[model samples]
Target chain A: MDTIIIDERIDVGAVFKKNIIKPRWFVWKGRKYAITEVTYTWEDTQGAARVMHFALSDGNTLFEVSLNLTSLEWRLEKSSVV
Target chain B: MTRTILLIDMNAFFASVEQAMNPALRGKPIIVCGRGRTVVTTASYEARVFGVKTGMNLYQAKQACPQVIAVEGDMSRYIDASHNIQRIAREFTDQVEMFSIDECFLDVSKTCRNEVDPQNIARAIKHTIREKLGVTCSIGIGPNKVVAKIASKMQKPDGLIEIREKDIPVLFALMAVQKLQGVGVGRHISEKLMSMGITTAGQLGNTPLEKLMHHFGIMGYRLKRIGEGKDDSPVDSSGGNELIKSVGHSHTFPRDTRDISIIRSYMMMLTEKVGLRLREYGLMGKTVYCTIRFGDFTSWGAQQGLKEHIRQNREIFFVAEQILARAFPLSKAVRLVGLSISDLKPRDTQQFLLKEMEKDTTLAEAVDDINKKYGVFTIKASSVILSEKFGIRPSCGMVSKQALKIKV
Candidate 1:
């Protein structure tokens, strides 16, 4: 698997129920991909912004998406370009 | 009542976390390593079968296991998983002591008194971890900490052993002396005992205390206790926070370099890290310590004492830089550099004496708040960035956390 860094902002459809973030789908580069499974979830910070990261897979490929809480922005940080 | 201590040792922690997340590399031989570090941090059981071991460089690992897959480890992932596991363990017993990133000790004597079996707790922990986190842990339960830690390692991947108080003698008789690490016995001490025909824990325990003391001095008494599986150490939930003698950070160069600019940049970077940690812990120190290791690994270090306690990175770096410039051998290419502070005391909560002092404190606090919410290095000095440009990022090489603590 080859990893490609793609720090691009995207639109994510997610559920925030009881402090849990489950990303259902995201639109990146004009293509909407339904998240088949959330492989990994972790958290980080940028300055004062809490960022939640999720490694989402749409069956064949995996993409790491991060959401900055302060700005409420979703970004595609990187992807396992298979 | 005898304490029931359980040591939960995660099996191949970093590699296991990677496998848990990806799933594709579940059964394959894999070695988890950090970027720019050739040393393997953790190797999977499949890799261990091929003789691959932690700390082995990539070349040596490939030589041992040609098919081993190399994965760059993410510390945040492991830390998060560890936190979750610790949270789970606390559900059973409040006396959970985090031993390391992948290991912990639980004093279940109180919990067990409630009629809950230690084995059931261990089994439940194992089941919950495997089901929720996709990893397994080996748990060893004994009357004390030492035996519990040793027993945990007896089985791999997913194993549990409960050593009763009466089982010490029989168990020690069969166990090798070399197997005991960080349990009151040093390697050279073990070797010395072995030369005296003491090849097992039983033999070591049976050796005359007077004779052992005559040879090893004060440490001999501790060694004897370890040999008999007699450890009374409590499961300290403080997690060594109260035991921190100093907050320090060090980095080794990828290659030895005598460049003044690079050295200074790295020193400033290290000082920043130490200073940040000190402030985070609400600590102030009156002395600055700096060390330099040459190309041949011979080290030289010196400490500078300040008039007043300081926690600011700039102030600490100022002293650290002078100590390095005045003492370090300029002719020698530097392989590693370290910066630390001693004579630590809690930071004063009093109001600043001067307006400038208050301004500086406010600025520092604001920056810290911003970084805490955002991420580390979000607002760092330009010199720190220079260290990165020079290719000397923090946690640079084989200087593991355990290795760093050894020197201090």
Candidate 2:
């Protein structure tokens, strides 16, 4: 699979349950999409910044979203079709 | 009272995990490597079918299969999957030993009853791992750890094989001598054996012990026993209880450099990583070792003993720099640098030092706490800031709990 790096900032709607953050909805490039599932989650460190990475789907396409905890900013890192 | 050991080996673990996570990547040839590194770390079976092998550079792999998908590896995800796989093995038997990130040995002799067969246990493990982790493993069941390891390699992707003691002779007769575990005879030794007209496991096993010993020393006897499929090593399950020998970190520069400032910054970065691990494990060492490899691939190593044990970054780097100074006035530019600490003892609670030393200790502990809570390099030494700016970090090696975890 080919990966296209898109470091664009986006809006995310998340929920805090039992000390865990779950993304429920997101708007990317002016298109709002409802998240059907969060397949996997992981953490990575770039220098001092901690990034929370999520692999989620919107019923048709899969996307990788990264949240920089230090700045509280979200970026769509990459995406693929189901 | 024969014991049964099962060895589970994951096939193309890094590439397999990437395929499992991405539905679009399944059933396609893939290679896993670091972002800028040329060496291939893992290749899926699809890529292997096209004659691509590990350690091949990207250019060579492309020549073998031009359409191969190359994915930059994520070590954290692989580590998480390894922990989960070990947990699944423990469900079958408490005697589970993690041999590496993608391999484990489980002692099932005690767990199996008259109604339960060892093969059934292996099947259960394979099924559960596939269902829960989305990975496949090949399992080998034998009378000992060595035979079990060999059995695991007899097939790939998803294979299950059992080698009984009574069948060792027949099975080994058809196998290559080098296929035996722990018997990595290099080209020279193999040529010598061939001159003696001995080429397979059966010929080696049938050779007289005195003649083999006269040529190869004690290792010859060990090889003879291995050729006969007899190994007494037990599957050790004392992971948490195992003693800590040494903690170290090493990095190879993308390009060889003669710049003293760049070399010193990299040294400090590695020392910080080593010190953090030592403190996290509640251990301190009195000896610090430094290794330097030159551009021509010639290497030098030296160690120095300290008056007191140390588990702080500055102290470790200070001792390491002292050793480096003795080896300096370089004959050639440096290619790689490594730092390790050994001769360890548990941390002492009593603090008997000057005010400045005590203050430094407190400051180091505070920085460690913050980095553990947030992420690595969050609070590093000012001298090592250049390392962060240049994105210098430790190269990946064998997987260990201490190497993977930032916090307990």
The numbered model that scores best in TM-score is 1
- Candidate with top lDDT is 2
TM-score, predicted candidate 1 vs. hidden true structure: 0.89
DockQ of each: 0.53, 0.32
Lowest lDDT block of 10, candidate 2 chain B: B399-408
Error of 1 at B133 (Å): 0.8
Q: What's model 1's interface RMSD, roughly to a tenth of an angstrom?
A: 2.6
Residue B48 of model 2, lDDT score: 98
lDDT of candidate 1 over B1-408, digit per residue (tens): 788999999999889988777655779998987655567889999999999998798999999998888876766677677777888788888888877778889999988888889999999999998888889999999999999988898898799999888999999998889888666677887888889888999888888889889999988888888888898888877545454577777787766788888899989878767877788889999988998888776889999888999988878888988898885458788878988898999999999789998888888888777767666677788877777876754234232223212111
Question: What's the distance in Å from true for residue B145, model 2?
Answer: 1.0
Once superposed on the true structure, which residue ranges of model 2 sit more than 4 Å away at CA? A1-24, A34-53, A57-62, A66-82, B181-197, B207-221, B252-258, B292-302, B305-308, B325-336, B392-395, B401-408
Give the residue spans of candidate 1 off by over 4 A: B239-243, B252-258, B291-302, B305-308, B326-336, B349-362, B391-408
Q: What lDDT score goes with residue B25 in model 1?
A: 71
User: How do the residues A1-82 of candidate 2 rate in per-residue lDDT, one tens digit apiece?
Assistant: 4566687999999997997889999898899989988877766665467778887878777788989999999888788653
- Candidate 2 CAPRI grade: acceptable
Give the alpha carbon lDDT tens digit for every residue of B82-104 in model 2.
Answer: 77788888888888887888888
